[model samples]
Target: MRFTLSALALILTVAASSMTAGQSTSGQPPVTFTKDVAPIFQNNCQVCHRPGSIAPMSLLTYEDARPWARSIKQKVLAREMPPWFIDKNVGVQHFANDRSLGDRDVQTISAWVDAGAPEGNPADMPPPRQFPAAEVWQIGQPDVVVSLPKDYIVPAKAPDRWPDILVDPHLTEDRYIKAVQIIPTKGFTVIHHIRTSIVEPTDATLGSGKLDDADVPLEVGEQGVFLNEYAIGKQGDVFPDGSGRMIKAGTKINFQMHLHATGKEDTPTNVMLGLKFYPKGYTPNHAINSTTVSAREVDIRPHTDNVRSDGYLTLKKAARLLSFQPHMHNRGKAECLEAIYPSGKVETLSCASFRFNWHLNYVYADDVAPLLPAGTVLHSIMWHNNSASNPFNPDPDAQITYGQRTIDEMASAWISWYFMSDQDLKKEMDARHAAKTVPTSTR
Candidate 1:
């Protein structure tokens, strides 16, 4: 048979790959799904990519993954599929729940695909991973579930709706929550966001922010204390051990619902707030709280790009920052959190690329969590893109303002942290310094 030099080289390459299927050619074994790729997917991708999860496709087995091998390689190479969008070029690289792929992971997947995506030895496959059913909560069942008395209807096509739906959970005394979750009890696809807050008996909100009961239904966040929130990528919040959020007695939940029509009328729509509390009379070592550093007024001109907005919060008490959760609607591009020390030094703690679909809480690892002194300024920098080139922007020609709708824009970052005493802060920082400067033995 006649063959060109390029075709001859290609055949020889394939033959070489086939001969080195099991053994390493030069200290590097041939990348295969059974041995190398399966474990990576099992650890990083299978949580969501498996059946009964939010991922669009399943990758639990070679049969399921082989079809999408090329797509998988492309997504990981672009650092897009796993949905952890932190900019690796900057900021603290360690996180408690980071799902992004590492350099070796990318190389392994790429090599497998380029080498014909072999399945390798069937006996080398790892055991299947177990998971809870899709309907179960990630944090397990709660001690109490506060939900809408009835479902809220979402029309097939209409303007987005943000209504203050109040729910009463009878409690004779205060309760300390260990973990909390907010999820749509019925319609998951139609809702845009859900922000729930604790409204005490003497809340300052105008009128009764109650559903279908107040003359003007005011939202809870205007004055009430935040309890928890839910969006696309935010599954729930589990406070650290020995930490809890307090819900006082005689409190009502101002369950503000953000409903957007999904082109199909959804009538069976409701939300549920699940609370798992610590044992009674068990107080926590730290008092936990959360707040947002949000720009009061945001204006984005039509066809604009890299629109910047800034907000600042100075610490009155020494604090250890817990987590950084970026919140923005469509057209939101990127956000950063910086610590401005009183000594005039600025340290960029974390910078992340934002995707409106994934409103994630980037929890800093315990050891790497920033321990800042009092009066340290938390500078929140937010950028928006209103230009047509932006794929997620709702409208390229419309002027955007700071409002609650999907089309309108807002710049806000939700942060969870606890204020610490000066002495505790000093102790923590000194230990960290010591750890860094500790001498190692030559032996």
Candidate 2:
């Protein structure tokens, strides 16, 4: 019962140490949810980690995130969440739609987790981010919403389906579209990718194509001119001002879908296409030419790592690349886009780590978008990992070849660009060079 002064001090020191075990002792305040971490979640994780998203869990509130604090810390520290896989070490680093967290944001999350993931003052929490109401259309309200004629149902277990569903747009006059978004209304788990094309009235008959469960499409008729495509993580496409993709009057909208199957039975699911039109009577100066360079002879061996493939596309006319989106199935590891100029200079425009779940299109800033000469060649290099190390690989035992199914493998670079005259390209390049060379103080 006798307590010395030193004994009392020791007890108090132990209590203080217990209270601040994982917290900073250098006078810095402890990291808390409301004040520091919520803002970071709002800006980055909230987009896909919120409810109604493909993410398994939500991180919208303290209650929601506290349970997964350690997991969150692990993902952010590893640069796995937020689903941005752009390799920062090499190639072009700038992108208009970079969703990856900053170095400090990752640090903050790690610290918060270490500091017990405390929920500080509720008042310190930032305003909630607003999302779309009826649907999550990143392109906003569209001038027209096109739906598949009938909802397509995938069985509990089935091979990848590439059924072509045709629906007439019934447009009375030609319209230039600035944006396009295709969203799967249901069965997000089983949905693979949805590709759309416009079958102009000028073309021949819109043929029918059916992909049986065991069958792979060899030749399925005209795919039509591609309008746009949607994958699991694609936000949508938005063309620059004064440029767009045109939908001719009386055109049939072809929905070429790849719906794979999960173990459980999915509800009858359908896709919705949103098209935002340009202003009436406003003619676009340029037409967006969406193209791809595909390594058609894909041969991915089982238990292999770092499988390599290359594809090339030479510009027939001078063009400016607007976006770079790498396309692959489960085993895709990484891809790089390089510009092989006629002057013998090679430049890697971008190199992004591949995730089968997210086929994100990295758009370039308007000023820095690559403007290549007519003779410039675009080199697309892709890598595949088929070993046990690849987490997304469905089966590392099977050999994969180029096919339309989600199970099979392919190597492709999907890009959106617009062709321009030789003179126009030279003028644009000259303007760009002049801007960089101008003396800042002299101006």
Candidate 3:
């Protein structure tokens, strides 16, 4: 939440400026793989495009990329690769983990392909980047790791599975958690998402080593504190400095696993969630909180191109905003978040050009986090396109509503923040106002 984005900004900026810094600036000098495109892929695409990852093909090597040169050029030109959909021309464009390609990089790749996709001298290539192993912990080792009681079998051709498991950490004392990472042992290939919550269900036999009901999502009142979630391309949860989420001593961890079918024979998986606790006796300056604002009630007319819905939430107390994740289904077109202050002034917090396939979490830079006092209402607006023009839309003639399947539509904004006192909130507001008056560069 409070991390610097200078590194990622540098990656985007330098990749743009370096292309024309000392070169002829005349005729482009025959852009080639080693000389032009490799570094761009290394910094931006290899994370998900490599082996054992979610992407269908790897771009880590020249041989791997040569076959897909034209396709790569097309995707990048369309701003579809690297899977970043934040509207660059819209609200707060600087994010901590932005992986979108710069215009210059895209141009470079296009030119390289136009010139027959030449392979420059191998000696000119830079050192290959080192990525964490597929099964290794993204954040270092955790304080404790808990796994599912038994491996769950996912049939080859079945409806989407929502297998819920109960995990009890059995803590004798309250623990302040700094981070949590959920890893799918053998199900990463077919796993859609994994959500965890801290709950104290009244049922005494819940965590009795048996799979819970699949319709657990409908029971909102029984759900506990929102902990964290894991989806494709999401690097686990690591709280900013001086912030933590508390867990009561007797609380049970509820694991809601969403497994998708890969069209293969029975596959088994044992998912795990790792917890990193803060040192004992250390109190955090702020307590992290999360809320999922969803507009469950929606009526989308058949063949509609611009169906819209708005979900609203008004805060009870002051809090410092940390991050946001805007979600929608296949027909989703765009997502936006706005803040309406007590004075009736509205400010755009963040907006992303939504794509159903790539669900991204946008974490704001620490310096940009605004302090919202009581009565500040947050608006989450989502736009959908269920017409024939939308290639991802499964059916353009059926009215859509909120349901558990992907074909059914959903509109939600998962917001994360930390509670702060009024006095501290004022200080943050003052700092934000003072910083705004100064001239700033556009993203």
TM-score of 1: 0.78
True-vs-predicted CA distance for residue 222, candidate 3, Å: 10
Clashes of each: 0, 0, 0
**How far out, in Å, is residue 415 in model 3?**
0.5
Q: Ten-residue segment with the worst summed lDDT in candidate 2? A: 208-217
Tens-place lDDT per residue, model 1, 98-151, is 878876677678778878899999999999987544345666789888899888
lDDT of 2 by residue, 1-443 (tens): 22365456645654554455447684677888999999898878765677755466798999999999999988876677877777655555567777788766777787788788899899999989876543588998999999987888889877656788888868888888999999888776666678787776764233212112111112223455557777555678888788988777788888977666765676577889999999888788887765566675788889999899988877767788888888788899999998888887887788888987666677777777888787788888999999989988888999988776778877878777777888888787778778763111111
lDDT of 1: 0.75
What is each predicted model's overall lDDT from 0 to 1? Answer: 0.75, 0.75, 0.73
Q: List, residue by residue over 75-116, the lDDT tens digit for candidate 3.
A: 987778878777665467666667789877877887787677
Show model 1 residue runs off by greater than 4 Å.
Answer: 1-27, 133-142, 151-166, 181-238, 254-272, 279-283, 437-443
Clashes of 3: 0
True lDDT of residue 270, candidate 3: 76
